[model samples]
Target chain A: MTEKKKTTIVLFSGDYDKAMAAYIIANGAAAYDHEVTIFHTFWGLNALRKDQQVPVKKGFLEKMFGKMMPRGADKMGISKMNFAGMGPKMIKHVINKHNAMTLPQLIDMAQELEVNLVACTMTMDLLGLQQEELLEKIEYAGVAAYLGEAEDGNVNLFI
Target chain B: MTEKKKTTIVLFSGDYDKAMAAYIIANGAAAYDHEVTIFHTFWGLNALRKDQQVPVKKGFLEKMFGKMMPRGADKMGISKMNFAGMGPKMIKHVINKHNAMTLPQLIDMAQELEVNLVACTMTMDLLGLQQEELLEKIEYAGVAAYLGEAEDGNVNLFI
Candidate 1:
């Protein structure tokens, strides 16, 4: 019998679509019956946080003022695009329309599917996010810890 | 009137989920009238290539072997974890399941969306892929080219 492949997805984009992609992929891996693990790092850490606030970016002039300010992921949120101001509402509509899960739904699916979810410690520190602020189910680890997981998998995705 | 936000997505992962995420985001961004660009580098380039081929590691042993193979995101195709026996089918399944388009479809979406699709020249050279081998619509540029775009945007995503 052929052996099952081990896969790990390292998510770095905190944006909605990117996070949704990670969630979908993790769900796909689980469907295939592979042991899947997701590691959230840097900006990717934002989505895993329990606070889940939107990110805010400075205006063009504000960006020009100096070093620029940190943009929170929650504020810049994924624009639903064609739905006009209805991107978020439409997203929820479409996901439900297609029976596809939402980001939060995907997150729930990850648990039901038993995918390992880990948040990067370094990013958490850089962002000043406390462990208590992230989803309680997520495991916190350093870069080395993530590398250890990567070392074991044949598939590693930086999303 | 508020100045429009121009966004660039730096795609580095070639996994099914990541690819799906980039596409969904691009499609969403286009719907919103945002100027969007996607720069494909490293493993991300694979999904864009005409000949899309990725090796699936079978088991623990194969994964260990994969890790020892190389650390860089060079020509060695991105690894798909535990693909087991169904490689081509799996790829198709993902594409169809998500109503996701192919590399060709993705390119078309970018064009229709006016999303600047760039192929990293350095990565192309490393992988022995000439400009001709890539989708006809893509622009080939170096890292500096992509950085220039990112420097100006209020939004940047590494997916």
Candidate 2:
């Protein structure tokens, strides 16, 4: 007999495409009748903002460092896959390409599918972001809270 | 003129769909002309294995624990995602659906497109997997080595 599967997705990528990927995967799991939870932290929190992501240019030193450094988030933050200028565009394309859902869709899907959504308080503090600044229906918690959820025998994923 | 992008991808999910997402994104980046790297570790290493993955069952105690648990990879080992039973099937579906490239195809694209593939040594140690056991193109490195790549800037990701 088929047993139930519980999966948790941790989003660390603040990048649009990566976040989209997480959202899509979570949505897929929900479609498959799996319990899903998403923990957003760090740059990942940027996706939770109710506005467009403002590109921040590094200062002279940072720019120089960035010049010598890697240029994309996947490489810098999660995995080193440069989305180039196409990161955001490709995200929209694939989502459209697959008729895949959006962040809001994923969020609503999370609720309808009973997926848990948790925002990292520590990350919020670091970013000077308030819980109220996030979209409605998000649960605010700390790393400890996330770890507690991760302790369950299901599956945990970092996106 | 658009500047060049250096990117890297860290893959921890061995599940087929998640791995396909990484590859899809990598292919997209390569199409856009960027340097890419993928560091696979833990369950992510399962993608590199020649044999199929063995399904894991939760014992009675594990089942009870699952009831109270968050259901994720942290409890399983390191940071990874449990892709449900559909993982392998979904991977095959998506790949076939897209006429998506094989791991070798993706690797070749990375090579032709200058994508670097690295395997995490720490995870290899914990999992008792050997370097020789992986695909020929894979390069093994310690976390520090990955950090070195990240420290130099470019892009770093943990997926």
Candidate 3:
């Protein structure tokens, strides 16, 4: 049997637009029959959070992170021209007008396409995110696990 | 002479962190003796802005863009955890503490290393950024020009 090509993406941004780009690329790579793994770290972890606040215990720093950062994809602002939060609303309007999938929808599609969504344990520990705060059916690991997958990957990217 | 492998980076975000990543990768590629071209567009155009605002005449929309967006690298915000602009300052502090090159320095190094920097003409026109408002050394092109470079490149990334 032919060995499948692998694509690994280190998603490190939590901006709605960047998250959308990551998912688009991940889904495209999967469609081409590549084994895809997206290592979501730092701000990228925000994408995994549920919209509603969950009752999860955390330390002082973690609690601060949970309160300050947006709940999930729905609350993410644009990377630039945020204009006090109006930019994202405009972008969402445009996306809907163009019949493009929302960031949340693309994420769900990525899961359905079997793109491995792995949260960074180190970031989680730092930010004080609990497993219960994120989506289900995802993997959690440290940077070493991501390195292992990326070691043999034909295409590796940090987005 | 043997042809060098080309790496094309589409820098679409103008946030300080994203711009830092894009420049770091470009510089890294140049260090590896790869031909690198960074196509800066939309928000990415802000990266090329002058630290001190130049007296370039712009139309109504262009003037609006200029007034709303950050002046240059030093003025950019973080992609997430901005905390109303404190996040970038914190990142800058960390960057300084580590003795890492600042974003402007990275751009300079990339230029010294002969990494091609191209501005998107369409975006510039849309954003009302005149060439005089940016650094003198750069190429200006549309999507087709970028596609031409990307078509033959071995590695292509969008940031």
Candidate 4:
């Protein structure tokens, strides 16, 4: 039997458009029958955060970070032409107009396609995010785990 | 003889810090005897712009884009905490204090180490950048060329 082709993506940006691109690529790879993994790191973790607030213990800096960052993918802003949150609204409008999926819907589709969604543990700790605050069934790991998957990956992207 | 590992990077950000990360990885891969290529696209093309202004004919929108974007790596802003350009100054200060190489110097070293630097031709046209406005001795190609290099690469990243 042939081994599966691997596609590993390191999602490092928190921007809504960038996250959408990452998920779009991840879902596409999964659809092509590749073993796909999306490792969420740094601000990218915000995409995995639950929409509602979760009660959790944290230090001053962590709490400050939590308060400062968008709670979920829906709250994240676009990377360009943000125009004080207007860009995201406009993008959502376009998505709806074209019958394209939003970032949240893309994430759901990625899950449905059985794409591996991993949160970088070190960054999550630094950002003061706990497991309870993220979506269910996602894996937690570090750079080493990412390197392991990417070293043998057919498509390794740091987005 | 065994083949050398390959690393391909898609640089899509205009931020100084992100560009630095991309160059650092590219330099590291070259040092390790890997075939490395950095394909600069979209806003990332700003990093390749000549610091001096080149008189080039352009349409109204292209001229506006040229006026708005940074002229070169030295003029680019940080991804976060840009505080009216103070952040880049602080970063340059810290880089000096730590005896680290600056972005321009890193690019110079990448060239010295024979790391391939490619500017995406499609984006260059879209952004109104001519070959004369970019650095000398670099390549220009589109997404197909990037995919060709990346499909067999060991470490592929988009930043």
Candidate 5:
């Protein structure tokens, strides 16, 4: 038997459209029976945040950054045409009309499909995101861990 | 003799930061003797625009889009923290201070280093961009062209 095919995606964008693209690709790859891994770092970490507060501890700057950033995929702004948040609201309306999954729902689907979600520990540290502030049931690792998986993967993507 | 490792980057963002990342990765791969192709599409096509106005005929919507969109790498705004375009200006100042190459300069270096640059034909057709409006010496192709190159590529990224 041949070795299992793998696809690893490094998600580095916090923009709604970009995060949607990454999840769409990840879901598609998983459907094709590929071992999929999504490594979230920096702004991408915002996707893993819970919409409701989790009561985590943070310094002044960290709290400021956390408050300024969108809480979850649902709150993400479009990279362009944001129009002070109207773009995302319009996008959500469109998605609802099309009966398509929201970013948060896609994240759920990815989990149900067993896609490996890896959080970048270094970024979490830098951004002051604690484990309590993020969604549970995800892997926490560094760039080396991602590189090791990427080395032998048949397909590696950085988004 | 060793097989050539191929890397294909699908540049899909118009933001300065994303464009910078794509070119930096392409240059790095080229430095490592890897065959690199940057398939620029949609918003990413902004990076390929010439600084000077090319005076191409366009439809009303296309003309409006052309007028609204930033021209060339130097005019691109940051994906975030744009703050009415001050973010990119600050970034430019920082790059200048570090003596780092600007986006336009990076594009020139990519050309000199022999990195294959392909603009998406469909996007151009949809956006009403003519060949005369863009820089010379780059390939214009469709998704099939990108897929053909990506099929054999060990690393394929959608940025």
Candidate 6:
């Protein structure tokens, strides 16, 4: 039998819109029967964080980073026209008006579709995020893992 | 002979650092004998704009967009820590100190390396940019061209 096509995405932006785009692509690829993986790195790790505060120990800088970042996908802001956090609201309103899914719903759909959601462990350490602070059932890996998957991928995207 | 690997990038961000990353990866892939193409779209088109102002007809919104966006790669801002344009200066200083190439130099190198630099025609129209306003020797295309290149690509990144 012919090998299945692979689609790997490196989600590097913390912006809500960017994450939504990444998930949308991942979900679409998965629906098309492509082996899809979304590797979350740097600011993108914030998307995997649990929406509620998770009590975790941290050093000064790590604590500061943890505190500064959005708790989860829902709290993340849009990439443009943020207008001090108003842009995300407007986007959500538009999504609702169109009867489309919000970012959280998109993530849920990705999960239901069995999209491989991976968090970059290096960035997680840098951001002071612990396993308990992230959603369950997600994988943790490094850049090497990403490169390994991407090198063989039919479509590899660094988003 | 084995087929040469392909790397295609959809540059969607206008930020200087993002553009630098895209070019760096493109140059690296080209050096490794990969057929690399960078599809500049949306704000990414600003990287291709000529530094000098070109007299082009435009509507009011287009004129405002042209005036607002950076004229070239050198004038683009960083993704973070911009500090009101200070961030780009600091990044330039650091690059010089390390004997690394600046964004403009990198673009020149990409041209010399024969990397395919394609501007998205659709975004150019929306942004009110014309052929005369962009650099010479680059191509203009749309999403179909990008998807055609990316489908067979080993690395297809959206930056």
**Model 3 chain B lowest lDDT segment of ten:** B89-98
Q: Cα lDDT for residue B148, model 3?
A: 96
The reply for model 4, stretches above 4 Å from the true place, is B10-77, B81-152
For B1-159, candidate 1 gives per-residue lDDT tens digits of 976566677887765445645665566566666677889887777656554333542466534533433222222221222235343344444445445455446657777888888899897666555555455678888889888987776446677
Better of 5 and 6 by lDDT: 6
How do the residues A2-118 of candidate 3 rate in per-residue lDDT, one tens digit apiece?
A: 999999897888888988898999999999999999988778988999999899777555677688888998888787788886999999999999999999999999999999999
Clash-forming residue pairs, model 6: none
Q: For candidate 4, lDDT tens digit of each residue in B44-119?
A: 9999999999998889999899999999999999786454556788667756754677899989999999999999
* Candidate 1 local Cα displacement, residue A85, angstroms: 3.5
lDDT over C-alpha atoms for residue B152 of model 5: 66
Task: Give Cα distance to truth, residue A50, candidate 2, Å.
Answer: 1.6
TM-score of chain A of each: 0.76, 0.69, 0.96, 0.98, 0.96, 0.97
Off by over 4 Å in 5: B1-6, B15-42, B45-151
Stretches of candidate 1 off by over 4 Å are A1-4, A51-76, A79-84, B1-159
lDDT of 2 at A47: 59
lDDT of 2 by residue, B4-51 (tens): 675667686644446656777877777777666777764576666534
Task: Show where candidate 2 strays beyond 4 Å.
Answer: A1-4, A52-86, B1-158
lDDT of each: 0.62, 0.58, 0.84, 0.88, 0.84, 0.86
Candidate 1 docks at the CAPRI level of incorrect
Q: Rank candidates, TM-score, best first.
A: 3, 5, 4, 6, 1, 2
Off by over 4 Å in 3: A1-3, A15-42, A45-159
Q: For model 1, what is the error of residue A64's alpha carbon versus the real structure, in angstroms, after optimal superposition? A: 19
**Tens digit per residue, CA lDDT, model 5, A1-159:** 976677788999998877876786678677767788999999999999999987877899999899998998889887775545566775566566547677999899999999999999999999889998888899999999999988877668787
List ranges where model 6 is wrong by over 4 Å. A49-67, A78-102, A105-109, A119-152, A157-159, B24-33, B50-67, B78-114, B119-148, B154-159
